[model samples]
Target: MTGASPLRPDEAALREAIVHTAREMERLGINQGTSGNVSARCADGLLITPSGVPATALHEDAIVWLPLDVAADAPVLSERKPSSEWRMHRDILRARPELNAVVHTHSVAATAMAIHSRDIPAHHYMVAVAGGNSIRCAPYATFGSQALSDYAVAALQERYACLLAHHGVIAASATLSRALWIANEVEVLAKQYLLASQLGTPPLLSDDEMAEVLEKFRNYGMRGTSGNGAH
Candidate 1:
């Protein structure tokens, strides 16, 4: 997901991207087993990983498609069940019209921070990569619940990623690769923050400093990349 290149847009290609990303997340150690899910915006809806399926067992045809307009509780027509987090993904893409992909992970360090309900503050200027001075942690809610989806959408306001209290991390972006990249970056930041806290509290960048960083980030990092797929 780290800016290798933009993916091709055809449904066939996007399906492959979903499978590739799911496995890559596991391979990169950001996710394990069936704990994480991936999705991409497609015509009128989204293509998502299937529920209860490990990335190692996932295949392109196992991917599920759901219309964005459907209620989270509604039955889906696909042969396979979409990820339990489909509601969160659907709400995010619907709310953030510009974002085309979503990656959810139970990465160890990030979820460790989330278990404490801590936000990732601007302990590093790279915090701006998430489109904010901090990565907010949404209040705890049962997985797959509509309440959880609501909190996640609000926490992600003006940001590409957020942590779920007692749950995991969610990273969304304009493309599948960028979403995967942001998901990885969130884990890195969380790990650094935890390491720094061992010294009795990490120094934080001032709001003014973070503002400057955010300004510089507007024309840099993942946002600066340009390509044809998932603009």
Candidate 2:
């Protein structure tokens, strides 16, 4: 079963969400031009951002739809080329079945942190958005290649998000909206960490403390807590 049986009716909603999120990223200065791509798994196929298209100019029909199954060297749904990083997107979906949405961004801070010698420590609880610890950066790989896809899959093991060294950040979630939110949160946290480090050795949370917060987060609903306890 292709993840909820391809909601054709939901395609409009999905397209709108992708367009809005891409525009939002540009507005927030997280993505520039058409440097990043986003995708959401649908029952019919995967809905992905078309390559070389500016976020501001993306229309609903401009979004490319690729079938979950590869058929005769083409996607069953359309003839258009998928994202340049389609393999990475496909691998992420294959590895994390629960993840319905994936957001990849070329944000400055996160990309900078990805190339750093040290891992990003859990300095704040917001890191829980990335599986409740710290985001791991996958080793550097040539973009748009199987090596990069494999590296991303490895880094995403047991985590909801990962950074691509010298490239960008990738975040996945059960929903497209949540994935976008988490991606934004990651960039924010990365920027904060970068700034703090410039101030001469930022304080990091201890392992025990991070574990405690992660446990608490699990009880509070691992996704996130709403204003009410309904989460």
Candidate 3:
């Protein structure tokens, strides 16, 4: 038998954050249908949106909690089935203790580039906000498969965000809001990259230039910083 466990107490706010992020994706045009999912780490496991549930209709209690230490073959610990992409969220949360949340979406421009299996190079300094010189596209795999999860994890090794070739995007951070914000930035960068490509191969930053920006990111980007989110 698999090693799934039970939920813990007072995770009400995390449930709300997941629900809000799901719907926010819709509002922000980062996703459509129920094609995206969000999750936040909790005391016992992680809280995720229910499978196939529309974000507008999502309610806090409908969220599913999967214990961190659970074995893969175990029945899910909650009544509702979790998102099909739960494995990536689960793996990401397990692998990255510094990140408390994960946001995945089939955001338009990003997905368009991913359809070509192209990575977003450092055409703009804002790419550093993802903690990298470029956003790599994890090689394609069937959605919801363990292979896809593995590919995403590897692509995001030193970065908080990455695209899934022909699939979508993934962003994670210390907080749900920050994760969502980064997802939006990735989408904007994707849009920019796509637009610039129409003219010619876009100019890209040198590794040294991107390194300078990555350093700026640690002290910038987040709202409370002196640069006021400029990095």
- Best candidate (score: TM-score): 3
Q: How would the candidate models be sorted by lDDT, starting from the highest?
A: 1, 3, 2
What ranges in model 1 sit over 4 Å off? 1-9, 224-231
Q: Rank the candidates by TM-score, best first.
A: 3, 1, 2
**What do the candidate models score in CA lDDT, each in turn?**
0.86, 0.78, 0.85
C-alpha RMSD in Å of predicted model 2 compared with the true structure: 3.6
- Name the top lDDT candidate: 1
Error of 1 at 200 (Å): 1.9
At residue 97, what lDDT does model 1 achieve? 90
Q: Count the backbone clashes (under 3 Å) in each candidate.
A: 0, 2, 0
Clashing pairs in 1: none
* Candidate 2 C-alpha error for residue 145, in Å: 0.9
Better of 1 and 3 by TM-score: 3
Better of 1 and 3 by lDDT: 1
* Model 3 TM-score, all chains together: 0.92
Clashes of 1: 0
Q: Candidate 3 regions off by >4 Å? A: 1-10, 221-228
